[model samples]
Target: MQRYFVQESHWQENKVTITEEDAHHIKKVMRMTEGDSLIAVHPEGKAYKVSIESVGESIICVVREEITDNKELPQQVTVVQAIGKADKVEWVIQKATELGVSRIIPFQATRSVAKWDHKKQDKKVARFEKIAKEAAEQSERVKVPHVHRVLSLQEVIEETKDYDFRVFAYENEVRNGANRKLSEHIKEMTPGTEVCVIIGPEGGFSPEEADELYQSGFTSVRLGKRILRMETAPLYFLSALSYEWEE
Candidate 1:
């Protein structure tokens, strides 16, 4: 069944009124008519099986059943990923959502090659947000992950100060043959805890930036033996977390 995230105002008295882009998708793209069934996710993450009641200017659907499936991870993992070249950030947002990330923070690191103009930051963030929403629906995730506006490395460190745990995916740590794997650090985190994992860009973090992050209480950990690309590192961490936590 097709899925949509609807606002609370759109839902009332066991009926959901789909409008705007989603309504167009139903009417034109899917060609769904009366009695057709689809899943409508509530703003708070609850999902329901809804049957089309009417279709015209807006698609109206009546709740058929409430879905009880829980597709979220036990713990929330926020990926503080440095801005990379091209659409690599978009690629990261899509795949990270599939792997059950809770939030994505695009960081402008000292060594980051790609830079977003201040004027276009809103559009850039909005684009990533849209990608996350679509990916969430495709992956059957109960909740869509948030995409924060691009932040500087210093801003990211301060923003993540309140998280239950914080760690950086350091390639240098791997080179030094650090005995501590990301899994080891994650194992110490209890279920329901929130984690922030920082992954640098293609050129990676500068020595001073790494030192500052460590000083800011972020643990520097190695992913594995081999080094992964900027876009690939976060997925590796998320996959490891899923393996560790998922039943």
Candidate 2:
């Protein structure tokens, strides 16, 4: 069944209204008819098996039953990713959503090369959000991960107050032979814990930024013996998290 993250307003009682792109996808792309069933997710993260009732300007789906299977991670994992090339960031958002990230924050590291234009920030974030939503649907996720506006290192440090656990990927840990393993840290986290992980840009974080993060209660952890690319690091962490928690 196709999955859609329907807006709160689009859902009325047991009926779901899908419009625009989704409607086109159903009517044209999927060639789904009135009887076809799909999964419609509520804004609050509930999902229902809905069968199409009417198809026209807007597709109306009647609720069949609520889907009880939860695909979200037991803990909320938020990735604070430094802005890199546009395509790399998009890839992280897409794959991270599939791997069960609860939120993604784009950070501006000292060595970040791709900068976001303040005027186009909303547009850029919107595009990233769309990518997350599509990935969520593809992954059969009940909740779509959020993509926050770009934040500077200082801003991210201040926002760390909300997380229960914090860590950052530092290559120095590997080079210095620091026995920091993500699995060791995962053992300390309880269910419902909120974690924030920081990934550096292509050029990596400056020593000053890393120091600030460490001082701000962010533990330095190594993904493995080898260093990972900016985009690959988060996915590696998320995969490890899912393995430890879900598998």
Candidate 3:
């Protein structure tokens, strides 16, 4: 069944109002009509199985069934991903959302090649957010994951200060037994605790950036023997978190 997300205000008595892009998508794109059955997510609550009762300037779906169940990953995994080339970052957002990451933070690292101007950054992040939301719904996630505005290394260092568990994937830390530490770190995550993970850029993090993150309370750990690409790191991290918490 088709799944829709609507604001709580859309619900009044026995009907729900859907407008703007969603209404257009249903009326024009999908060509759904009255009596069509589909699933939906309420703005402030859970998913529902609804049947379309009206289709006009505004579409209304009557609540046939509502599901309060949540299918989010076991932990609150926040990926502080380095802002890379355009398409690469978008891929990260989509994949991360599908993997059940709770939040995504785009940042600039020392080796980052692309820089976003104010206007471009706004447009870019908005696009990624749309991608994230669609991916979330497709994955049957209870809540949509957020894609935050772009930040710099300094900003990320300060932003993650309040996170309960902070980690960074660094090859340098391997000499310090980074792999062993990653294994041990997995055993320590609390079920619902917020974890902040810092992933490097295309060319990877500079020594200075890595060191600064470490000083900011982010534990530098290794993903494995082979270096994962900038886009691949977050998926691996979220998968590991899922395995640790869910499996």
Candidate 4:
């Protein structure tokens, strides 16, 4: 079923009113007419099987049934990803959501290549959020992983201090030619703990910045001897976390 997120206020007594964009999409683009079936997700975590009863500036409908989502992971993994160009960042957001990431933080790393001023930053953030929402729907994610506004490296490190555990993907820090697999660390993580993973930008995190993160209680973990691209690292981490956390 096609799913659209709706605010809790829009649903009342088995009736749902779709507003703004959703209303337009159903009426104009999809050309859905009366009695059409679709799924509406309420902000309070209820999924409704809805039938279109009316359409106007906004859509009004009656709920045919209610569904409860129970596929969410026990642990929430938030990835503080370094800022990258448009395409790579979109890839990270999509794949990370598919792998069950809880949240995503795009930040400025020591070696980041994407430059943004306040005006441009807001636009970028909005675009990123759209990507996240679409990805969540495609992947059947109960909750869309939030795309947090961009932050500088120091700000990100400071902001993440209160997380239960923090890990940083460091390509250059692997020991003695041994492949540092994520599975090695997954066995130690307990369920329901919030884990934060940081993936640096192209050229990777500088040694100085890595040191500061280490001091801030983030353990630098090596993904492997062969460094993965910035866009690929978070997906790798989230996948490994999913396997361990779910199994």
Task: Give TM-scores for every candidate, taking all chains together and pairing residue i with residue i.
Answer: 0.97, 0.98, 0.93, 0.91
Q: Model 4: per-residue lDDT, tens digit, 98-139? A: 788888898877789887576787788788888887777677
Clashes of 3: 0
Candidate lDDT scores, in order, read 0.91, 0.92, 0.82, 0.81
lDDT of 1 by residue, 42-105 (tens): 9999999999999989999999999999989888889999998749999999999999999999
Q: Positional deviation of 144 in candidate 1, in angstroms?
A: 1.1
Winner of 2 and 4 under lDDT: 2
On lDDT, who's better, 1 or 2?
2
Question: Poorest 10 consecutive residues of model 4 by lDDT?
Answer: 172-181
Q: After superposition, how far is residue 3 of candidate 3 from its true place, in Å?
A: 1.3
For residues 1-247, what per-residue lDDT tens digits would candidate 3 score against the true structure? 6677787888887677889888898888889998998777876647888889989899888988777677888778889988878889889899999899888999877788888786787788788888987898788886778888988888877877887899888866654554374657877888878888989888888988877877777887888667788999889888887777777
Q: Rank the candidates by lDDT, best first.
A: 2, 1, 3, 4
Count: clashes, candidate 4 = 0
Off by over 4 Å in 2: none
lDDT of 2 by residue, 4-67 (tens): 8889999888889999999999999999998999999999999999999999989999999999
Candidate 1 steric clashes: 0
Looking at candidate 2, what is the lDDT of residue 36?
94
lDDT agreement of model 1 with the native: 0.91
- Pitting candidate 1 against candidate 3, the one with the higher lDDT is 1
Error of 3 at 165 (Å): 0.5
